[model samples]
Target: MLERLFESTLWNSRFIVILAVVFGLIGAVILFAVASIDIIVTAKYVVATYLSGTHPENFHQDVIGGIIGAVDLYLIGVVMLLFAFGLYELFISEIDVAKESEHDETQLLAIHSLDQLKDKISKVIVMVLVVGFFQKVGYTQYSGALDMLYLALSITAVSVGLYFLGKVGK
Candidate 1:
């Protein structure tokens, strides 16, 4: 009887995962909210600058960089959401609302195994990195042919990685 009780308790310990699921969701919500605020601020800045009829140095670059940064945050938030959903489904229970949804897109959050969850999270992370790379590139000044060549090589590498990533989904 003691052995069975211990076994039952050990099995029930999986409920601890609920903490991670809840906190991950909270983190995702915070990230999404911050990203939205960033975009709103960027929009206001652009509108104010145009209305003032004064284009600051690196104005376009700044605008693009801000938007790209927000995209990066949003992608990271997506990763957090996927993590939470996967953990909950794997440990707790299937989300009833998602299962009931007629929209095929809801299946994106359905995770059947650890590998599937990892793949989904990694893909979103790659997107975040790509966005961050572009955000950094936007602010970089190319001073010479060698710099331009390096930039081209880096972009080619990113493109190749994305191509392979896409093939993995197929």
Candidate 2:
């Protein structure tokens, strides 16, 4: 019994790691794209500013903070994303196992359910983020461009979620 318990604990640890990695890959891909965009935009701005021979006060501060914060957020998101993905996978696994014993077609059904779950979660996050943006802007000033950026990021996240749902669940 002691040996059996040890084995089970070891197995669970490895299983958790595998699940974390699976989701981390997708999360990393998204973060990589975002980081690349930031780098390109910032590089252009920095070069243009230097070339113009004008020192914008506090410009260095924004550039440094932006670079650091962008990476930090992506890293944090990776950790969180992995945990969320593991939970999502556990649910999908449970459905797969439960249906396997009864049905000739379990994968397809499980995939559909998982896809729907992903889309629903993505929509909820987007809604909340948009509402927060509106609240933030309301307290200060409003910018149409902010709205557009929020919309674009939300759509991108949803699209990526859809792709993963099809890959893992289907």
Candidate 3:
């Protein structure tokens, strides 16, 4: 089923990209909305309403703050999820690696091709992971951009590896 998913039309289609963009857009909107909530809530309740003698309960403050914070965090999470799905849609495609493994024979081109592919993939992965770690630590946005590039390159390597196998299979 997992293999089929990578091979599916849904994955290759533009629909997935559109869905991902929408999710990111919604998340951004949520973030923008909640960011102003703090100012508005404090201004209205602490200043304007206070002069009118409408003091709210203290415990309610914590509850409301927590709820708003949670919503903000959830929006960020949703954005990340959508961006990840976008990356998957852009870079990943299916080739039956299992099929390659099951074959009893090997050709020189297959071996060399696989070796080169492995080298390229491993280097790219390590580089991207290192960059991603830095990005996670908030050092730079460039690292995050590089991570997307690496993901695309990794997918291309995989496709090339599969093509090599096809050539050797013949």
User: lDDT tens string, model 3, 71-168?
Assistant: 44444544444353334334443224523676653221132243444443344344444433333433223357788787668667766755665565
Clashes of each: 0, 0, 0
**Stretches of model 3 off by over 4 angstroms after superposition:** 1-15, 53-55, 59-170
- State which candidate, 2 or 3, has the greater lDDT: 2
How well does candidate 1 score on lDDT at residue 52?
Answer: 100
Better of 1 and 2 by lDDT: 1
Candidate 2, residues 11-45, lDDT tens digits: the string is 66756555655666677677767867877787888
Q: Tens digit of lDDT per residue, candidate 1, span 35-125?
A: 9999999999999999999999989998998899999999999999999999999998999999889999888999999999999999999
> Is 1 or 2 the stronger prediction by TM-score?
1
TM-score of 2: 0.35
Q: What is the lDDT of residue 43 in candidate 2?
A: 80
Per-residue error at 23 for model 1, in Å?
0.6
Better of 1 and 3 by TM-score: 1
- Backbone collision tally, model 2: 0
Q: TM-score winner among the candidates?
A: 1
User: What C-alpha lDDT values do all the predictions have?
Assistant: 0.96, 0.58, 0.49
Off-target runs (Cα >4 Å) in candidate 2 are 1-25, 84-170
Give, for candidate 2, the lowest lDDT window spanning 10 residues.
Answer: 133-142
Best candidate according to lDDT? 1
